[model samples]
Each structure stands twice: as structure tokens, then as C-alpha cells.
Target: MRKKIIEFKNFNFKYRVQAEPTLKDINLTIYEGEKVLIVGPSGSGKSTLAHCLNGLVPFYYRGDMSGELKINEQDIRTKNIFELSKIVGTVLQDPDSQFIGLTVGEDIAFKLENYCVEQKKMKEKVEKSARLVDIDEELQSSPYRLSGGQKQRVTLAGVTVDDVKVLLFDEPLASLDPATGKGAMELIDNIQKQDNKTVVIIEHRLEDVLHCDVDRIVVMDNGCIICDTTPDELLSSNKLGVVGVREPLYITALRYAGCDINPEMSPKSVKTLNIENCKSKVKEWFEITTISEKQKKCDTILELQDVSFSYSQEKQILKDVSFKINKGDMVSIVGRNGAGKSTVSKLICGFYKPTSGKILFDGKDIETESIKSRSEKIGFVMQNPNQMISKTKVFDEVAFGLKIRGVDENQITERVHNVLKTCGLYGHRNWPISALSFGQKKRVTIAAILVLNPEVIILDEPTAGQDFKHYTEIMEFLIDLNKKGVTVIMVTHDMHLMLEYTNNVIVLSNGEKIADDSATNILTNNEIIQKANLKETSLHELAKKCNIDNSIEFVNKFIDYDRRVR
Candidate 1:
């Protein structure tokens, strides 16, 4: 009989700094080889639960604890973090923060070195793990220089090299691109199946994992496990929506079409879900309408004319890349890791000088523009909020840019408050940055940029570690900003965000532009999808399969069904 790999019986915990428990009475048991996904909105105690399982709760974090917790059928109270590490391998959300070595190979070998493993055996394990995670080519490269997805893969290699029985991933897919995220999901499933290892994933992006052979769904809310069930049953249940977990987009599309359908149906078996009945429901929902008034008036705001960039004399990162973002346009730049999406943003903001060609903003050459002058025209929000934040308090963090530019103190206060309200950070204005959750920190970063009121805004992976609700709010806020003439360009790997928020899409592969066109057009094109290593949005595929040329309605139906199922 398989042993229970993890057990939480009437467990409750409160951080030393907090007045209340972060997790409460979380009763859960994960058996060997079970692939479970724990999900919730931001601050729902998902991270707290993960911490408990890996011994971070009582070991490193000073916290008030109640109830019992066991791993590998042994009480957690008896083991320190190092002993737990022998049983459970943990991969955190940010890969850079966990990296201990300069190169990928060295990073993967660090943990083994601490265990006193012989150098020969360590090298063999490192190579094997590197190949397993498909990062053999990156073994010699500096981890700091790799893209976010590559960094994440390297972190996985480091964790798995220990040959731990159970693996815990905290938002593993957050930093990965569509193709890489899918590959990571498949890899996790493969590991679980081949080794009979217990797999626990805390993630907000449910779409990919829902189809990846998950065993169970553990939904949390306000420090409690509100529901525990199989993925199909969870998706099919109405309580999930009440509890606020993100349902599958395909199911949502079906629901929006006025069809009473269950989201709990396995996505892999979508073909058998009476797909024909779903077609007309979707048609009625969308009504084949043209682009909204807000979607129109997207005139050319910035143009890259045969732009090429290189940091070294050896090779160009961006090769003659050219694209246009019209006024009131929300455009997404997407590609595999290290494909120059962020580099393009840097060049547009004058952080990096292009090797050849030109960038035109509002029909004026920006190559000669001073960094200070360019700062007034473009607001750049980096991927990591911690990097952007300088002040201790949220209000100060939001107002720092304006204060530096010599704005009046009173006006800065007013603008800061207004932007905070817009970004849903008003309630926490005076709170310290350390007190806020990751999603809240991201909002603070965006609010700081928005307060600057620049003509153009660029966000690098804005929704990377955010939950579904936060993701939607940020996208909607950006859409509103674009409607008011703030041209928004986002460097993203989020396919759903691109489909729902952006009007224009740019596809890149191996540092070269493969396609630039309307979001709908680019997403539907097989050539671009293949070249860019992108997965098709489920609703988009369903429409094509059912001969639904006008896709809006079909997608809407899915939206409706998805809501009902959730």
C-alpha cells in the first residue's frame, strides 16, 4: 500500500507579525504519486500551507502553530528543514532568488556539494538533471543572464538533482512562457508517474495544470481549505465560483453562450462534450459584433524601423526587428525565453542603445533623446516590484517618481492617492512594502508608473505572479488606460491576457520577428503559433473546429459555461 506522503490534521498557523492565523485547520492528506494543485486568490493562505508542508512554517518563520503536520508519515515537529529537504524538493516562485551558483551547472551542483557527495557523482547527477529539465545547452551559461523561463528551468534542475521523493512547486508556471509552461507541466507529470513521487503545486494559472493529469484540487480561502476534490469535480462544482477560484477559460466561454454546461468535464475529453450543442450557444452570446469604440482609434504611436541591437561584438539579440504600436493600442510582445522581448522594451526606453536602425516615438527620433527626456515620455514598470520600489511605505513608493521630478508636495500626495485608488492600493497606502502580498506589491509598482502620467507605458511581465482576480483587474485597468490614449506595451508570456486584453500582437522567435498583426489573426495563424512556440487558446480552437468563423460568440459561450462551472 502507498504511504501518505503528506498529512495536515486540524493544522492552523499565524505568523509572528500577524494578529490572526494565515492558515486554519487545514486537514489534507496527499498519498504517494498524487499530483495535487492548491489554488486560491491572493492572500488566501496558499503560500502558508506550502510553507507548513516543507517545514518553513515553524523552522525559519516564527509563527504560532496549532494542530498536527506530518510528511513521509513522520511528524514534522521532529524534523528540521534540512531533514525535510531530504524528502521534499521545493522550487519557489522566483528562480533568481534561489540561485546559489554563477552558472547553471554550478547551481545544480551546489546542494549536492553540501551533502558531501563526491565530485564525480555530483557531476553525473547534475548532467542527468540538466538533461531532464531540457537545459543541457545552458549548463555553461551564467544563470543571471538567462531569461525568466530559463532561470526557472535551471532552478528545477537544481531541486530535482537531490533525488527527493516529493516535490513542492510554488507558482512554478508564473515566470514561464506558454510553451515552457506547458513543457513544465508535462515534465512534472512525468516525474510523478515515473518516480511515484507526491507532487504539490500552488499556482493561480489553472488552465495548463487542469489538463495535465492532476489528481486532486485543494481550494483555499482566507486561511482555510474550503474544498478538496478531484479536478473534474472541482471544475464542475458551483462552489468553486463562490469561493473564487479561476475556472477553465474554455468552460467560461461555453457558459457565456447561455449553455448550461459543467466546467468539471475533463478538458482532454472536451471532444465528447456535445460540442455541436455548444456552437449555437456561443453564436448567440457574442452576436458577431465589430470591435468596440474603445478598440478603434489605434493610430500609429511608435514605430521601430529596421532596429537591431547587440550587447557584445559577437551576436545581435534583436535582428532588424520592426513593429508599430498605434495610439490607444494595447500590444503584447511574446516569444520563448531570451528571445529579446524585454530587450525591445529597454531599447524603446533608451536603457539600451540599438546597434543599428531607429526608434520613432510620436514621429520623432528617440535615439538622440536624453534619458531624462525619455523618462517623461515613457513609464517603464519592471517585472520585479521589489526592484522598482525604493521607499519603505506604499504611499512613498508610489510618489517617489513624482517627488524626484520636482512636483509640488501637495500635488504629489493627491496624485499618489488617486493612482493608489485606481490600482486598488488605497487601503494600504501607509502600510510598509514588506507587509503587502506579492500581488499588492505589483499593483504598487504599476500605480507608481501610472502616477507619472507618461504618454506611453511598458510593463515587463506585469501578471507574472499574480492571481486570476488580480490579473483581470490589472488587465482591465491597463485597457482603460489605453482607451484614454496611454499606449500600453506589455512583455508577456500569458496567452489568455494577450487574447483578452491586447488588440495587437507581436511574435518573436530566436531573436527575430516572425509575425506582427492583430491579436485574433496572429493567435489563429498556425505558422506564427508554431514559430513562436505558443499554445492555442481553447476557445479559439473550438470555434475553428466547429466552423464558427465569427469567434466572438463561441468564446463568450465558453466564458458563460466556465463561470457556471466555477
Candidate 2:
């Protein structure tokens, strides 16, 4: 019989600041060598459960707890944080936050050093771990200079070097590009197979996590586990959407085509999914779901002419980059991490002036205008909400922009309330910022920018840490604003968002513009997808396998149909 690695019985926990329990009457069991994926909407107690397992709940968070929880058959209440670390190792969403050493080698050796391992043995372990993660050549490189994927590998090396029996990944793919995310998942799969370790992954990107072989999937909502089942069973059921979790795109597409897939038909990854059994159903659905083509707009609202910028002479971030964004356009800037996607947004927003080139807003040179003047016409929402939020109360934060512009008090009240309602934060207008969840704080920052009534809004990874429900809510609001003639430009690594929402896509590679075309065209081109380090959607591959004519066109039209129906 397999050993039970972790167990929870009638577990309940309430934060000191909240009135209700964050985790309610939880009962769960995880066995050795089992890979489990935990998914839920924001504030659904998924992270809280992870905290409980890692000894952060009562030890660091100071929460009121009741019930029994065990790790390796030992009561967690009897163990402190330091003791828990020996058995359960946690790798956080932001790998940089977990890094303690300046270089890759040092980072991997940190925990071993703490344990007073011999110098020769510590060096051997660090080198072995680095090799496992395929980063042996980067051992001497600084962690700060590594890409998102490399930094994550360094963190993984550090966690695994200590011979921990259990591993916890807290949204490992949250900040990575699609290709890098796939690599990370594959690395985890290899590690699990080699070590036979008990692994648990907490994430909102269900589709991405499904790329690996998950033994079971646990769905949470409102601090309760609504469903616990295998991937096939969960995908076959209608419970995912009901609980505000997003189902995989191919699965969603099958259902949208009016086909009831087999309950036992679960494929490990989208790339390897066999759709031969459902070809007829898919063909019928494709024939019915047709959409008309949209006409292109030509009014240029923002233009970058031969722009070049550099933090120092040693490195040039953008070189002779040029592009024009039309008014009312929903444009997406996409590329791999460190490919200069966010830099383009910053240059447009006047956060960094180009060393040589011109940025024009409404045919006027924005470089000549004051930062305050430029901000009035263009608003930039940062990637991190905590960095943007300044006011204690949500109401004041949203209303501050208008008050600074010398707007009347009555008008400020009217504008603030309307934007808050649009962003779905009206009910919590008077609540303190500290009381809000990460997703809620994100809405507050966007609401603050919306009240300013800018012509164009630039968002950097706006939906990075958001759940599917909140993501849809925020995007729908942006779509409504776009219809009213506000330009939306998103810097993102999410292919689904780009294909479903944006009309145009700008491909950037090493701070240079590679392609400017329709979202479908850019994604469907294998050469461009490879050159830009973008992942091809499974829907596109499925269309080809079904022998469907005009596969790209079919995928594009289906996305349009899906967007309209939603």
C-alpha cells in the first residue's frame, strides 16, 4: 500500500483580518508520488490551503485554525516553519522572490550551506542540480541577468538540492511565456518521474497545467472544495465553468460545437491530443459557427517613428522600432520574456524617452509635451497592482486622478462611481486597499486610470495573476470601452487573450519589430511563431488533423463566433 504523504481532516482556518474562515471544513488526502493540481478562482482558499501545508498559515499569517492537518503523518501543529521546510519545499510564483544567492551556483548551494553540508559535497550537489535543470553553463551567471525561465530553473534547483520529499509549486507559470511555460512543466514532469516525489501545483491556468500528466484535479471556490476528480472526469463534466474555472480551449471548443465528448477521453497535453474520434462532430460544428470579416480602421492615434532606446550604451533595448496604432484598435504586443514587449509600452507612455526617434500622439510630438500632459491623453497600468496603489481606500484611489485635474467634487463622485461599477469594484468602494485581494487591487488601479478618461490605455500583463472569472470580467469591460473608441494595447504572454480579443498583433524580438499583422495570421504562421517564441494553439493543430479545409480561417472564425456568443 502507498503511504499517505499529507492529510487534512475537518480543516478550517480564518485570517485575523477577516470575519469568516478562509478554509472551511476541508478533508483531503495525498499519497506519495502523486501529482495533484489545485485550481480555483481568486479568494477561493487555494493559496490558503498551500499556506497551511507549508506552515505559513498559523506560523506566518497567524490565522485561527481548527481541525487536523498532517504532513508525512506528523501533526503540523507540532512543527515550526523551519522544521516544515525540511519536509515540504515551496517554490513561489515569482522565482526572484525565492532567490537568495547572486549567482545560479550559489543559489542552489544556499540551503545546503545552511545545513552545514561539507564544502565538497555541497559543490557536487549544486552542480548536479544545475545539470538536472539544464542550466550548468549558467552557474557563474548572475540570477538577476537570467531570463524568467532560467531564474525559475535556478529556484527549482535550489528546492530540489535538499532532498525534500514533497514539492509545492505556487503558480510556476504565472510570469513565463508560452514556450517557457511548456519547458517548465516538462522539467517538473521529469523531476517527478526521477525522484518519485509528492508534488502539488497551485495555479489558475488550468489549460497550461493540463499539459503535464496530472493524477487528479481539485477545484475550489469560496473557500470550499467543490469537486475532486481526475482530469478526464473534470473536463467531461460541466462543473468547471459553474465554479468559475476555465476549461481547456480544445475541450471548450468540442462542447461549443455541440459534441458530448467521452468522459474517459483525457489527453495528457493539447499537442498530443488525438481528435480522430470527434472529427465528425467538430466538422459539423465548424460548418455552423461562421462569422463575417471585420473591416480595418485607418485612423492613426499613436505612432512610433524610428524609436531607439537604451538603459546604457552597453545594451540597446529598442533599435529603430516603428509602428502606428489606429484609434479604437485592440492591439497586442507579444514575444518571449526579455524580448522588449513591455519596453514598447513604456516608450509609448513616456516612462522612458527614446534616445533617437519620435513618438506622436494625434500627429503631435509627445516628447515635446510634459509628462503630466502626456498622461492626460494616455494612461499606463503597471504589471504589479501594489506598486500602483497609493490610497488606503478604493474610492479615494479612483477619484484622486480627477481631483488633481481640478474636476468638480460632484463630477468626481459621478465619474468614480461609474468606473468602479464598470470595473466591478463599486460594492467595495469604501473598503481599505489592504482588505482587497490581488485581483481586486488590480481592478482598482485600472479604475483609477479609466476615470482619467484617456484616449488610449496600455496594460502590462493585466491578467497575469487573475482567475478566469475576473479575467473575463476585466476583458469584457475593456471591450466595452473599446467599442466607445478607447484604444487598448496589451503587453502579454497569453495567446488566448491575443487571439480572442485583439484585432492586431505586433511581434517583437530582441527589441525589433518583426511582423505587424492580424492576430490570426501572426499565430498561424509557423515561421513567425518560432522566430518570436510563441506557442501554436491546439485548436489550430486539431483543425489540420480533422482534414478541415482552411484550418487557419476555421480557427479564426471560431474564435470570432466564440467571442460573440460569450
Candidate 3:
């Protein structure tokens, strides 16, 4: 039998501020060198559980704890935060928040310096750790100067330098692009095997994380561990969908085609998935599934004529980028982190003036329009909710826009309440914004924008950290608003979001407009997907693996079927 590295026996913890326990009656054991994944929806106690493992619960969070918790067969409650750190190292969801030093070498060596290690030994350790994460070449470079993927590598190296026995990752792929996220998982697996360390990942992006291998998947819901099983077992059951976590797209596609999936068929990774037994069924279903032609809009509400942008004379963020968005149409802007996706949105919102080019709204040149004047016609929901949220309560934040416009008190109340209901935040209308989870705060921010009732809303990663249920809720709400003639432009890294909701997709690569076409066409094009750092849909791959012709049409029809079924 494998030795247990971490164990929790009837553990329960409650934060001082919370009325109820965050984790209740949990009994879990992780063996040495085992890789495990913990998943759940927002407010499902996953974060609290992770906090308990790293000693953030009793030391930092100030919570009431009961029952037994052990790390390496020692009661963790007897150890302080410093002692816990030596056993397990944590890599936060956002890499920037964890960074402290000026350069890559300093950040990784900061931990050793605190321990009063000799100068020569510290240098050797830092160099070794940097090389372990493949960041040795840029030791002198600033961590801030690196890309999102590189920033994560620096943080990973910083944590691994401590040589902790357990590595805990919190939403590791939260801020990464599709291809970059896949690479991060592979790197993590390689490190785990090379170091023989136990790994625990807390994430809601189940499909993306499953690109790696895990010994077991622990599913938490409503402050409890509802299921603890292998990935194949988890994917074969309906538990993931019922819990509002997304099953892999290919698994969902197999079920949609009426195939019986079993663990023996390797249902976890797409590359190893065995579908020979159900290939005929999938082919027949693809043959019968039909998709209707999409209706195109003629009127262009917004147009960019050869727009170019640069932060400085040295670096041009965007070059001669041009596209048109039709009125009442929903569109997606997609690319890697530095591919100028969010930069394009900022340019459209007039947050940053283009260095060169013409921007027209309804055939009117608004180059001279003030930011306040542009706000009246265009609404931009920033990526971080903390940037936009000003009031403590949800109602005030939602009504602030209308209140400042000289709207009557009665009208503001009615409008804000209606928007709150539409955003699934009606029950929390009076709750403090600080008490809400990240996903709830996201809905609150979107609710504030919807209350303004602008003709066009440009959102940056609207559903970046949201689970499947909230993602579906927000996307379906946007679809309703689109049908009611609200044009939505989203800058996102989620490929599934583009294919599922948006009719038109704009792909950016190296600060240039490389592809402007339908979502299916863009996703199915291997060359375009590679250029933009995007990943192809598993449904497209599934169709091709089953020998179905025209994989593009197969993906299009599947999206339609999914929308209708929902």
C-alpha cells in the first residue's frame, strides 16, 4: 500500500465571518507521489479546502477548525505557517500577485536569502531551479517583461526552489491562452515525475487540466466531497454535468451521438480515447444532424479602417488591423495573451487613441469624441471586477450609472432590480460585494453594464474563471440581449465560447488581423488555430477520428444541437 502524505479525518472549518462552515465532514487521503485534481463550481468550498492544506486556513484566514488533519503523519494543527511552507509550496492563480523581485533570478532566490543561505550555494540553487523550469536563459530579465506563460514559469521555478515535497497549484490555467495552458500542464507533469512530488491542482477548468494525467479526481459540491474517483470514471458518469462542471467536449459529443462510454475505452485524454466500438454510431449521428444557414446582417454599426496602435515608438501593439461589426450581432475577438486581443477592445472603447487610423460609429468619425461622450454610446466591462465596482452593495453599484444620469429614484430602483434578476443576482442584490465569490463578482460587474442599456458592450474575458453553469447562464443571457439588438464584442481566450455563442470570430496573431470568418471556419483551420495560439475543438477532432467528412460542418451542427438542447 502507498504511504499517505496528506489526510483529513472528519475535518470541518468555518471562517470567522461566514455564517456556515466552508468545509464540512470531509475525509480525504492523498498518497505519496499521487497526482490529484479537485474541482467544483463557485462557492463549492474548493478554495477553502486548498487553504487548509497550505496552513492558510488557521494562520491567515482565522477560522474555527475541528477534527484531525495531518501532513506527513504529523498533525498540521500543531505546525505554524512557516513549518507548513517547508512541506508544501503553493503557486497562486495569478502569477503577478506572487512575484516580488525585480528579475527572474532574484524572485527565485528570495526564498533562499531569507533562510540566510551562503551566497555561492544560493546561486547554485537558483540556477538549478531556473533550469528545471527552462528559464535559465533569461535570468537577468524582469518577470514583468515576460509573457503570461513565462511569468507562470518564473513563479513555478520560485516555488520549486524550496524543494517542497508537495506542490499545490490554484487555477494554474486561469490567465493562460489555450495552447499555452496545454504546455503548462505538460510541464507540470514532467516536473512531478522528475521530482517524485505529490501534486494537487484546484481548478474549475476540468477539460483543460485533463490534458494531463491524474491518479484521481476529487469532486466537491456544497462543502462536501460528493465523489472521489478516477478521471475515466468521472467522465463516464453524468456527475460532472449535474455538478455544473464541464465534461470534456469530446465526451459530451459522444453522449450526444448516443454512445455508451466505459472506463475500459480510455475516456480521459482525447489522444488515447478509444472510440472504435462507437465510431459507426457517431458517423450515423453526424450524417443525420442538420444545421441551418446563418442569417447575415447588412448594416455595419462599427468599422475600423486600417487602425494602428503603439504604446511607444519602439513597440507597435497593433498594425493595420481592420474589421467591421454588424448591429445586433454577437462577435468574439480571440488570440494569445500578447496577440493584441484586449488592446483591440480598448481601442474600440476609446480607452486608448489609435496611433493611426479611422474609427467610425454609424458612419460618424468619433476621433474627437470625449471618453464621457463615448461612454454614452459604448459600454466596456473591464476584465477585473474590482476596477469597476465602487459601491459596497450590489444595488448601488448597479444603479450608479443611471443615478448619475439624473434618472428618478423610482426608475433607478426598478431598472436595477430588473437587471439584477436577469443576472441571477437578485437574491444578492442587498449583499456586500466583498462577501461574494469571484464568479458572483463577475455577474455583478456584468449586471452593472447591462443596466446602462448601451447599444454595444465590449467585455474582456467575460467568463474567464466561471464554471459551466455560470458560463452558460452569462452566454445565454448575452444571446437574448443580442436577439433584442444589443451587439456584443468579447475579447477572450476561450475557444469553446467562440464556437458555441458567437457567429463571427476575429483571430489576431503577432499584432495583426490574420483571420476574419465564421466561428466554425476559424476553429477548423489548423493553420489559423496554430498561428493564433488557439486549440482546435475536440468535437472537430472526434468527427475526423470517426472518419466523418467535413469536420467543420460537424462542429457547426453540434453547436446548434447543444444550444437547442440547453
Q: Which candidate leads the pack in TM-score?
A: 3
Model 3 C-alpha RMSD to native: 1.6
Q: Model 3, residue 543: what's the lDDT?
A: 85
lDDT tens per residue, model 3, 8-112: 999999999879999999999999999999999877899889889899989998979999999988998789988998898899877887998999999999889
Model 2 C-alpha lDDT per residue in residues 133-246, reported as the tens digit of each score: 999999999998898899889998998998898999998988898889989999999999999989999988888888888999999999999998888788878888898888
Candidate 2 stretches with Cα past 4 Å from truth are: 271-274
lDDT, ranked from best to worst: 3, 2, 1
Question: What TM-score does model 3 achieve against the real structure?
Answer: 0.97
Q: How many residue pairs clash in each candidate?
A: 21, 0, 0
The lDDT of model 3 is 0.90
Which tens-of-lDDT digit does each residue in 200-285 have in candidate 1? 99988888776587788889889888888876677666656776666766666565555666543344334434566566766655
Q: What are the Cα lDDT values of the candidates?
A: 0.82, 0.88, 0.90
The number of clashing residue pairs in model 3 is 0
- The lowest-lDDT stretch of 10 consecutive residues in candidate 3 is 464-473
